[model samples]
Target: MLSLRTRGKSGIYYIRGSVSLNRQTIDVKEFSTGTSDKDAASHVMAQYQMQLHNELLFGPTAKVADVTFSPEM
Candidate 1:
C-alpha cells in the first residue's frame, strides 16, 4: 500500500509504502512527487506503485511502456 504526505515547509507531496512479495516485505523509500497538488501526487503514487508491481511480477528486465496518468475526459 502507498500513501501521500507533505514534508518540511515546502509542502511537496511524497510517496511512501511497502510491498509484499514471496512472503517478504520490501520497503519503498519516500519519493518526492515534486508537486504540491494532491491530485498530481496521487497520480505519481499510482504510477510508482504500478511500476513496482510490474517489476515484481515480470522481473527487472521486463520491457514495459511508461505509465501515464491522465484525468478521464
Candidate 2:
C-alpha cells in the first residue's frame, strides 16, 4: 500500500509504502516528492511506484543490462 502525507509543516508531499520481495516485506518510511502540489506529487509517486515494481520484477541489474546490452544479440 502507498500513501502521501505532509511533514513538519513543509507542505511537501512524501511517499510511504511497503515493498514485498522474496516473500519479505520492507517498509519504505518516507521519500520526499519535492513538490507542494498534490497533482505533481501524485505523478512523482506513480513514476516511483513503477520503478519499484520494475526493480521487484527484474532485479536492479536488469535495468542496466536492458540499457547497455542484450543477451540475445
Give per-candidate clash totals: 0, 0
Error of 1 at 52 (Å): 0.2
Please give the TM-score that candidate 2 achieves against the real structure.
0.73
Q: Candidate 1: TM-score?
A: 0.76
TM-score list, all predictions: 0.76, 0.73
Q: Give per-residue CA lDDT, model 2, range 1-73, as digits (tens).
A: 6789987676999999987767756477899999999999999988877667667788877567546654895
Task: List per-prediction Cα lDDT, in the order shown.
Answer: 0.82, 0.81
Residue 25: error of model 2 in Å? 3.4
Judging by lDDT against the true structure, name the best candidate.
1
**Candidate 2 accuracy as lDDT:** 0.81
